[model samples]
Target: MTLKHTISIITFLFALPLIAQEPDPSEAFWNRLQSHCGNAYEGNLALPEEDESFGGKKLVMHIKSCSDSEIKIPFFVGDDKSRTWIFTKNNGILTLKHDHRHEDGSEDNINFYGGTASNTGKANIQFFPADVATQKMIPGAATNVWWVTLDDKTFTYNLRRLGTDRVFKVVMDITKPISTPEDPWGWVD
Candidate 1:
């Protein structure tokens, strides 16, 4: 065989294993997270975030009480901005619901709900909120784009204002689970 042809054959053979490798990291990560589909925990998050509403100021938020279905989070910003995250999973779709209110019980800047992400529900560290329409938004509203990252036991979220380039990040450490159903927000009588 010609030298060039021989080298081509050898390269092809070597590349087969890489292509045929057992599961990809992403798949493995997804599977691992699926195991914790019904578990919850508590932890802390520390990250820098910026937004136009705050005049390009970055602040830290506190997170608590985490379960597969819901998470309670408190913002470090003044005025008692605390929120609860209700997550629902169904047929591989993970949805997010937000409720931020003061002690007096008033709406907190329009609670966010119906946010969806891939739902293997694994414990793997992952990043999300990958919609371009949501990434560019202005203040006073939540953008279509939101990102969440999970690492073993920590979860982080990145959000943008609706219509501008303002970006905000929230780091969360789960405290405990309040429920166990995969889809607590599912339709029920």
Candidate 2:
């Protein structure tokens, strides 16, 4: 073969690995969130102001634990530490799961129901549509879409149920850190 062709093939072979590595938008988002690791932020409901349970409660989110592939964020509505937002990443894919537990550290029936990212979203946001697991776990939740948006000033967790009038959004001010709350339900240490 000609030297020119041989060199071209050699360069292409060297670039194969780089080309095979898909861009993971989740990594950037994860790192943005990880920047707030070990910190807590206080926020309030921004969408519906008439939430009976979350209306007057002090809503706090603690970036309790973080790892290379997962982040555990405990969301406390008043004294109820039963809700946690679990963000897990595997093979460059991201999934969001809700971990619900009772005060006794027992799993709730409606737990771990969340979705996986349908695509590698932008740096500031990623959308997670209800996965099959969520559809099987909750009736009528098949249309749910959850997303988290993070920036230097704020972190927002949002949910929108397709074909319905249900939407939930919580905006936390990351610019100001709050005292980390206690361990969430079922959390050791």
Candidate 3:
């Protein structure tokens, strides 16, 4: 074969590895969420009989803060601003926790209960089952499972209580992000 053709083949082979290597699913999921940082979206309860507190109330989710390893999203139910969903990444694994606060900025007794992803989920989805802390904090929640899914048009947060019929889901439209909402309780700026 000609020298030029031989050189081309070698160069192509050298680039093959880089091209074939796919991005880590956790990292890709983080990036997808970070893309919506500083924006807010409105949604409604999408499953199993909404509670009275959340029913008839405006629901909003703000991707308020994002960093390389952590993200804080405040979920607003009407004027109650005491809930924030926190996502953290470490060692190729992702964890999801709920931060609940009082109006005075103090944490609630039943706060920070969540779970870690058991594996590197797909680029658009991750599942978190009840962790030790969650089980201890809320015994009834020991069988809970939560998952988040993101796609080109929508982002959904879901929950299911295994051994029971309880379920909750909220879907946000990524195509149209609204203005940022007021700061969540205990969060300044």
Candidate 4:
């Protein structure tokens, strides 16, 4: 081959990786969340009027377990340790699921209801609309939408039920991570 053609080929090969590179917000968010593994933070109800179960309680979220595909965060409300938030990434799509357990480690009747993000979303936020499983589990929540936002100072979990007046929000202080709390109900360790 001519020198000019060889140089052109080399240049194109060198630029191939860069040209193929695309920013992935889901991966960024997942890495940011994984960074908090083994830490716990405190939060308060952003919409106290909407959630009585979280009112007058000390709310804590512990990034207790993490893996390549999933992360399990235990959410403690005062002495109640029955809730866990599970985040999973599959084929570039992110999903959020709620896992509830009784004190004896038994799964709650209402559990594993959540949604998957439409795409990579943004580096700091992701919106999850109720999935088929969630809709099947709770017909009334078929229109539920959940979103989580993360930034330098805070991480927030929010929910809104379309066609209803239900909303819940919790904002945790990422700047002041506290002592990691106990495992949620049903946690083996």
Candidate 5:
């Protein structure tokens, strides 16, 4: 081979690995969330006033634990009961299984089920609760529709009821840092 041709081939070979590595858009978001394991953060649900015609109400959830596997968040709407959601990521999609049970290991108002939460570039989170058969349980129960600008520190949901055009925009803001180096997941007893 000629000298120029040999140098060209070497350059191409060196650049192959760099060219193959593509940046994952969800990496930053995933890393930020992963750091919140075993930590709790308080956030409020802000709903638009115009939606009051449909009887809108703001809700808040206390995120007790967060990890790559599962997230345990407690919704403090009316009762002190917590909803420990077990998350399983398949491919690029994330499925959160709702385990509605008390701290004593008893069933609550709802039973076990799986739900899909879509992360669209942190622009918003769309939740669709599914049945055990993997069908839509709630026609439109998505909540906390958040703005894209706050994607780094917050998440929003667009909640809807079954067979209804009424969409409630609820926002959840990350308030305080609850995770530390000592115990991030809070798994320790």
Candidate 6:
């Protein structure tokens, strides 16, 4: 065989494992998020028409902390840095939780409200229906379904309350990362 043929055969052999690997869209999603660690982005609300607290305030998302299987992102509404988003992966399942704290760094009563993905999404989108804990904590939101989508230039977080007219969405520009904010509430230096 010619040298070119031999080189082609070697390259194909090295790629066999990846070619035979099963698809894991969740992992792809996780990696996409992990790539944004230590960066911050500005966003705007695109639902509910208007809001008292969130309206007219600058919205920001700081993907400040990241690990192999966990990522913590702080969501800031103007000066209120009380909400953080925690994403975790275990046994190939992705989970999302809300970590809320007060200005004094005290945990809120209604915290960690989220759910795990249903493993029925693509690499750029994932849906997480409200889990048992969320239902028990906020009975009125029993039908809430949260989802996230990451594309080349934008990252969006959305919520839909099934059987109701409630919904929320925030679209952040990932293509333009802003300066990282200070540590979020309750987070020690």
The clash count for each model shown is 20, 0, 0, 0, 16, 0
Model 3 C-alpha lDDT per residue in residues 55-160, reported as the tens digit of each score: 7688899999998899999999999999999999999799999999999899999999999999989899999999999999999999999999999888899999
Pick the winner on TM-score between candidates 2 and 4. 4
lDDT of 3 at 4: 100
Per-model TM values vs. the true structure: 0.45, 0.87, 0.89, 0.88, 0.55, 0.88
- Model 4 off-target regions past 4 Å? 1-22
Off by over 4 Å in 2: 1-23
- Alpha carbon lDDT at 65, candidate 3: 94
lDDT of 2 at 105: 97
Q: Please, what are the lDDT tens digits per residue for candidate 4 over residues 1-189?
A: 999999999999999999668558898899999999998999998885656689878989999999999999999999999999999999878999999999999999999999999989998999999999999999999999999999889999999999888889999998998987777889975
Q: List the candidate 5 regions with Cα displacement exceeding 4 Å.
A: 1-28, 48-62, 102-104, 117-150, 161-163, 178-189
lDDT of 2 at 168: 91
The residue pairs in collision within model 3 are none
Comparing 4 and 6 on lDDT, the stronger one: 4
Q: What is the lDDT of candidate 6?
A: 0.90
Top model by lDDT, which number? 4
Q: Tens digit of lDDT per residue, candidate 6, span 45-84?
A: 8886597788878999999889988899999999999999
After superposition, candidate 3 runs with Cα above 4 Å error: 1-16
TM-score of 6: 0.88
Candidate 2 residue lDDT tens string, 7-48: 999999999999768556777888888888999999999977
Give per-residue CA lDDT, model 5, range 101-153, as digits (tens).
Answer: 56554666554455554552431233444544334443333332212222657
- lDDT by residue (1-189, candidate 1, tens digit) is 999999999999999998987555445544444444445433232333323343333223333344444444333332333455545444545555566565555665555543556544334543344333322332344344555666655567666555776565655454344333222221121
lDDT of each: 0.47, 0.90, 0.92, 0.92, 0.48, 0.90
